[model samples]
Target: MATTVRRTSITLPAAHLGEENPLPALRTPADPHQVHERDRAGLPADMARQIGYAPLRSLLPVRRLDGYDRHRTPTDLDAIVIENDRLRATVLPGLGGRVYSLVHKSTGRELLYRNPVLQPADFGLAGAWFSGGIEWNIGATGHTTLCCAPVHAARVPAPDGGEMLRLWEWERLRDLPFQVDLWLPEDAEFLLVGVRIRNPHHRPAPVYWWSNTAVTESPDTRVIVPAEEAWHFGYQRSLRRVPVPRWQGADRTYPVRGERPADYFYEVPDSARKWIAALDGEGHGLVQTSTDQLRGRKLFLWGNGPASQRWQRWLTEPGTDGYIEIQAGLARTQLEHLRMEPVSELSWLEAYGPLSTDPDAAHGTDWTAARDAVARGLEAALPRSYVEEAYRAWLASADTEPREILAAGSGWGALEVLHGRFKLPGTPFDEATLGEEQRPWVELLHNGRLPTGSLDVPPGPTLVAAHWRELLETAQADALVEYHLGVAQWHAGDRAQAVRSWERSLKAAESCWVVRCLAVADAESGHPKRAAERYLRAFALAVESGQGDTVLGALAREAVPALLAAGRAEDAETMLGALAPGVRRRGRFRLLAAQVLLALGDVSGARGVFDAGFEVDDLAEGEETLSETWFAVAERLVAGSGPVTETVRSRARAQHPVPDAYAFQPE
Candidate 1:
């Protein structure tokens, strides 16, 4: 059969992606994998500039997605499939346009690591990301906030006169629009993905894009890339160059040899083909090769340490085999953001398929031999010239309008386009897609003011880009107007103006949103005590009005932590006590309760939490809070009423090993 596209479903035990947390992400998720100041001591000028360019200070406009709990049901998720005669690719249109499965029809072999469940962890920039097949990471440094959100998907004409699946969305972080088109030609074994990132604005924008592919990993699996050295980044917060395949006295080619989670950004020479592959012991697995525009290749793996082992189980079912990540991006490292010029875009074509190479050469200790063997094999299957030709061919049909709409994304893109009068072709953000989130903003656009609403419920989603900021600034000052303007100003780096706007909004009406934002500003300004007080006030107001909604309960999660940080432990406990029974039972709040108990010197109460066994459903990839709290509880227990000093803490860590469930993150 020729290539075709159709809508389908994939059944899995999926944690319901609960409502977006009402709390604004005033701080980005802390990443120890990022480069440190010391890491820049010896870099070239261009590399240094790119690495340090446009790091995100906070995730404004976007809210944290921590409302999900440890609950899963057998659900039939919305999916789209692209099929050819030889291969079948399953995509999740409702959830980030992820390619969930790619199957080789003849061998019935799953080319990618098809995740058994749709379990979301706190991995993306805006939170709630899952581990699986192939995910396109766009926007800023971390995984895109759009990971759990929907994207506009449609059926478009392919380069080969066939239909292809196209996914597009407006990336809010850097205010750019991007599209990914998946195409399969007649009788072709390879899947071709054409990606385009556009800087529609007149000014330059920092861009980040990575096509991350997860493949089944084993001890004998060898990764082949065309590079002699790589820019290695570890959780140690350092980025330094090291020899490929044999770094730190281990054959880094094998995922099992890695001692800790790290990223190896291969320093591929300018003349080489851009590709990466992970072949099994017998030399058959997945290969990902992209055009020269997507020049960077990388390998990321969860190392074989105790922490890695625990994390492996946490991401999926326990005892399931782990997976390795081989990615292609526009920059040398995930830490760097490429600068896309005004009105210009970076486009590339990527191919994915099954590859079988000489097992002896691929698995050999000689890195050159192994990489060369795969490189030659890839050339035989699909050449660099052919990839370039395919990219040009796809570019020819890039402006072809969608034949049919498969799925709908957020209306933010439509809102932006309508406001800015942007003329983008091929990808249309139809006015029909606008929903409740954009209603007030839409009013502000046409009516010269936002519609006022009740102060009790959470305000509509905040729009913080420059264009939205201009509208909010001139709109008639009201509680909602000022509050949203403050968010926009904060996002624009005008802290003084943001604070003034918030203060003015509060003078008009009492709103939990404005107060919480003020509290965050206070905390960031080093007024911790005032921040804590404001946080409590915000939470109390939300509770009194929202009646313990899951969204409102999220503010409590922030308030208690703030109280404890301000050395008001007793206040933290009291705040926790006020929570409804159902709210307290949430895994996140249960964990917080333990911390509160510990702060109140109730060691036994804290210990009871662990004894009962609790799992934080959205525990992050590198987060070690579970183990930290466990040890703190252990230290208190070991001290026997004495003050738990450093020596006592050492004894606790030495004697009371954390149980498997909570044990993640290397010491």
Candidate 2:
């Protein structure tokens, strides 16, 4: 379907942007233009001050890995400081509407040019990033880097009250030596990243450092991750792939064409295990980095943008205008992993590597490169992958059945939704498999006490559907048990019986919430539109009843889609907009808004909403999904209308359905 491309860059009217968010300043500039400049372009800088650094470029101190140097020298540092060279930097307005800047740091002999005007607010001060503010990091040892300048400058205490560096510098110091310098050629073809952390403060610093990398956001850019198994839906990584002895329900494990719109993070094997890596199609490259050594570490992946906007971008297009980023882990997840595996506390850990562009590059054009790189790099960057290798034998003792799934739905039907068909691997996960505490909830579902929200609430759908012949009599209500059996029958492709059971369950329901659960059940059962309406109702009821944030979040997820399916964008926008400011703290809201805005083809606006919302959630690869979606939307808009160029469309088309999942078929 073609779309009309509006040449007019979507802008938030003055009113849409309320008060500025209180983002901590990174460094204080002498001229203060650094702080004043921001996401938007169009400001008059004093001409004399604009070129003020030209004469004294040589005075700027050059930062090196081991120590500070006076001049840019040949070293294995991420960034080097150039002292006393004429630095020419200008922010010029571009035809595309963003402000392009040509920055010449003569001391480093680097010409860093960027369209700085198009800054996404959520691209925060972390990792080796571009397209954000200009910032650099140099540690007591290891790499130094000269990155894109930041829109805002921050303040840091001077060593001798001379001057302050950027905010990121302090953050770098606080999280000192997170990475180690790898084999960098004199010309520095690639800046090998290393990360390390030590508890410097008297109190243990709660930190989670997620490895972050951004790729050209486009539909053709597929991601390939190596794992024994992946989730049927949602972002959780499975330790072992769910084995599908038989396809059950609507869930399938392997995707047919490519990866779905997902934010899944895996728990990789330790160094002792054969290393695995994630690769992109076309065999461009693959990198493998893991915290196999780090205990308690949880991985994160997400896709979103800006705050809570009405537009939504689905990540199923083919294109190159957008970007995808991978963040290792945040302080919340990383520190816990470190705490659990104290013996693995080495500053640097090999997370993963991207495949090299050269055909003769070490790992060749195989997935093994990713794993091999991790094995080699982790000993220095991340020592944990190596240390954890010893415990592999122990974990094997406590094993459970794996889940296998495949993707069989259309893009629109699947979209941002995650489907996890919980089929037990070895043991049948029937009512018996459910824990005692969970049994009551199961009974509630069976008894029609739980609201279907948007899914058909079945008591023993899996049990009755897949292995009904193995059913045994239990000490449960006869009607409830029978209703469950019916629901299970429905799940196992017995729709007629499922419907009858649902009707019976509704008649037996004690409360209206039970009916709501039925609605949820329906939605989960593929009736998204109906599920949406029920969710809205449930949301309203929850609001009236003063339901907690969790409940509200669930309702919002349901209601938004219902509104979308009902063609209630304006209403959804209003409701979501109203709920956004208050519930902006909720990750789901941010993601939902991003989804909507992407649908509206408002990529920039969607990004703004995701950015604002991400400050609270730090959605991680969630950003990648959103970025890819925008690229897709951009392509669609360009093709249908004409606001975006053909070049943009072509690029985007090459990047659709990013390879984010891996499926291995038997030989």
Candidate 3:
């Protein structure tokens, strides 16, 4: 049977109705081709013709495009036209260095685009595509997205009979060339942006997105974030005397510029509203967001410096650069903020930076003037409506003081020794005798610099283990100090002393089980079977105290090795399976999972986990240590299974190694 497709005839209203206009005179096939050129490089004749261009020639310029390959579509000429509902008409001035424009019939607006022509002196590679055709650049640029419209023309049904256009409504896009506008919505009380760790790969991939925002210029630029903790790594240091957070990254900064070098990585808290802000000289500023519920979030601020050399030289240089980044969820306390939430209505979490071009300028000043820009920005950028007002009020009411004080000048007198940075006054330890994995931190604290050590001190049993030698020499009367001593002793290969110290500490305070666990783990270090049992008990305590994922994650990793060594492979697998979701419930789970799988002899499975982990943990320029470690481990395992080495190697390989003296020096 033949099926007939029904076609409905639609009648058009008069051309004058609703500001509609009749189509302009159609271009006949006889019109000369429009030639718009920018930078001419890699285009070949066959490729050009298939995409509707005549042929690659000296007359046409070429251009390069930037951005991830997440939204790939065929660049077929027919596909572009059909997707945009417009024809790609060419005009004749195809000569080099000329500006070209694309006309949109519906709005009668012309979009100016650039295609640079390469001269013989210039090696023919094209530069990144500018604003006219596609959004190919990595970071945000005001001119990149001059105008935008939904790629799809379908309407989403609202609760009411009327409908609205939405990007999230559709799971996958069909159009080859579609874009959303960048301007703030009219009547917008607040503009919320949410970045998510989207895994397009079959396996889980580490997910990360550089959620860049281009702030308008302002004078007194300053930033404020509701960070209870911080981990400042990388090169440059802040000029001001403020405490920064400690994170899992490179060395801490030396105070220099008005900026602080930092990695913005963080584990998302149970509560969702972690806040960070940036303010100008006049006190007008912008704060990155959080949900109205006021859940705590992680904030990171990166500046131009040697650590971020590539970014400074390539992405965006610091001086006069305007941006403040906040990490809502993920692993490590340093590195670029990784997006870890799903897209939903009201999911923006509501954190954003608001700028003031001029604090002294009167409220009515025109937004265009350079001097009054700050004042104009506050008026144009902030939310004024009731809903926005309510949201801000809710955030203010729920905001809590941050607790993580690990930043600079967070001088932990005796505790610094616990980091394995120095020997106790009466102790016999020296740097050469320390384990390889332990030497860096110890040297760093002794020197008061990074590349030498981590900004963050080890926590949980690891911290306790690292400081045991020094603690053993302490007087028994110092209860709290003795408790930590127990922890350090356990980490330093002194089980009996660790137990004695922990028992004594507990006698002083029953709540000292936190330290006791460290002692017991140390005392039972050789007994993997016993250690696993003790670790489980400690893990339970950690969870009960609501100490957060870091503690739990540490406990899990510690036990996994012991469990595997004790031949409790099933238990280890079960343990990882049970806790993986809780620890890596955000976007960093795959990497954590890879570590677990690698211990289980599932080398292939571990590789998949690593590949997935990279989805969220993209290696920022200076973040190669962990990446290299994983790769080396994977490579070694691939070569063939062998006895595990007792020593763990440092992954911070420096082909272009900076001198020890200048490595972590502030810019």
- For residues 106-211, could you state the per-residue lDDT of candidate 3 as single tens digits? 4443222212211111111121111112221111111111111111111222111122112110111110111111111222323332211122222322222123
Q: Lowest summed-lDDT stretch of 10 residues in model 2? A: 407-416
lDDT of 2 by residue, 118-198 (tens): 222222232112241112222211112223222111122221222111111112222221222111212212222233343
Lowest summed lDDT over 10 consecutive residues: which window, candidate 3?
A: 16-25
TM-score of 2: 0.30
Model 3, residue 584: distance off in Å is: 43
Ranking by lDDT, best first?
1, 2, 3
Measured on C-alpha atoms, candidate 2 has an lDDT of 0.33
Q: What is candidate 1's lDDT per residue for 337-401, written digit by digit as tens? A: 88889989889899999999999999987888888899999999988888889999999988889
Clashing pairs in 1: none
Candidate 2 lDDT score at position 223:
38
TM-score of each: 0.98, 0.30, 0.27
Off by over 4 Å in 1: none
Distance from true position, residue 73, model 1, in Å?
A: 1.2
**lDDT of the structure predicted as candidate 1:** 0.87
Tell me how many residue pairs clash in candidate 3.
Answer: 69
User: In lDDT terms, which candidate is top?
Assistant: 1
Off by over 4 Å in 3: 1-165, 168-186, 193-219, 233-260, 264-274, 292-299, 304-310, 316-324, 330-620, 623-667
